[model samples]
Target: MKRLRLAAPLAAAVVALLPGTAQADVTYPDPQPITGQEIIHDPTVIRLKNGGYVSYSTGGVIGARTSKDRVHWDDAGNAFAEPPEWWYEYNDTGDPWAPDISYRDGRYWLYYAVSSWGTNHSAIGVATSRTGLPGTWTDQGKVFTSETTDTWNAIDPAVIRADGRLWMAFGSYWTGIRMVELNPRTGKAAEDATVHHLATRPDAPYAVEGPEIVKHGRYYYLFASYDACCSGVNSTYKIKVGRSTDIEGPYVDSTGKPLLEGGGDLVLEGHGRYIGTGGQSVFEDRGKDWLAYHYYDAEDDGTPKLGLNRLHWTKTGWPEVF
Candidate 1:
């Protein structure tokens, strides 16, 4: 989910650059049929070492669920049995949201946000788990933070590893997406790391957040949620993308417009029952890439549900979802 109401509807703005499957006509495909424990928001899913799958999302203590074949799921439990003491510093309830899970250095790293609604006083924290399962995480502590004085909000954290360096991309309506380097050993912000701006709307209260970076071919693709979220059926949340040859970018849409100037290629948008398709992450399994996100189900009266789609790449390296 995102903070602050959006200033305007996202540009109808740009069309996806798909060629074959999602080619022509702007057809937004429905999510793959999934059942059981499907309601979730801002989901971060990992294929466990046991060959099963576990997903953690925003809710009570970072709500969790599991699956055996990636179709049927079961409620597992919360990732944390209790909130860490420091979490209260950011928010009264110590509620955490928009978690990112990844495997690095032979262990799993979990990053999540703690903050109250509509405020930039936020913190992104880290926890580790050997098995990456619910109730098995060890709270490592806070990694980064932001306050009312900070231009960027430190929420919706997504991390990507490159060249032995850990980089976290985070932000919200305050100033769009931002990236900072993390200490490899500690998984915390580097002592003097500079926060680099990645994407934003040209105006104030820019509605871009939930940054996910994936290295494909020679470029790094930045995926982010644009417009409003958490409003049920009325939500205008959509997914957009930009790319850069360098990790610390200068990312731009297909037309070569810089993301810093509000440029991004429309990737996924609301269509049919799948409305507000955003809060996404990308993970590769069995040599193929997959996109995981949440959508407001129109048929279900705008209930948020898990959405999974196999990602296809164009010959030029941009991503496509059908």
Candidate 2:
């Protein structure tokens, strides 16, 4: 299925709103250029032990791209050259969506989503590696599936540790963001679950998805991508954020509005030069926070490519693009 597309005029309007906005301290690659293939989307950049970066993203096959300077990337080929047999057994046709890589408990875990476009029958699967690189990954099998077709559509898996417990926050389309505790040692959901409705907009052309969480100071912030994300040059994808003192929360925006009520502080939008700047994930490097996402390069013949910018937190504790 073709991905959802956004209206051109509306996308342009959102881009005009950005500029001179709050920014965080960050250093961009001297000359920014498209680093990987055009199909790369929902990228997760993880700093390796050897002081380099490895990225994973959505595609039919799990693939890897490496960067020495975090600017230029070299495709390391498919991490899983073939789709896991189990995924094929469950669903005859398989297309892997976003994959988030994390290292914990002496293992490198890759949590990924599998589904066909525009469908809610999605599942989040897991793979592991000892070296956290391509060719070394081993599929550990599916971790969670969307049990309730009426409520939440599970995809875009992000795992975080809070208050001595491991938790995962994931959802898309059907409702909003939902979280469940995980047994960190097993990388599986815990029995005691606490789910939160992070964001929803029933009146908009699109709904909330792509929940990427980070803890700063005394608050846990949830950053999500909203609107249509795959319309090529017509995409309206933008980044939004809400925060709370607790992990599973009634996260609120700067205006003191709960995320479930369509409240979010805008972080990145199409700025006329770049269209649909969302599907973001935060990477903290060298004591600074960097926003990694994909956007259509307006100047580069309008192709979707990976982009990175630094995130600045305002004195009042609000985050914006740098």
Model number with the top TM-score? 1
- Models 1 onward score TM values of 0.92, 0.85
Residue 183 alpha-carbon offset, candidate 2, angstroms: 1.2
Candidate 2 lDDT over residue span 193-216, tens digit each: 556566777564337888899988
TM-score, structure 1 vs. true? 0.92
Error of 2 at 248 (Å): 1.0
Off by over 4 Å in 1: 1-24
RMSD of each: 5.9, 6.5
> How many clashes does the backbone of model 1 have?
0
Candidate 2 residue pairs in clash (backbone atoms < 3 Å): 15-270, 23-322, 24-312
Best by lDDT: 1
* Candidate 1 CA-lDDT value: 0.87
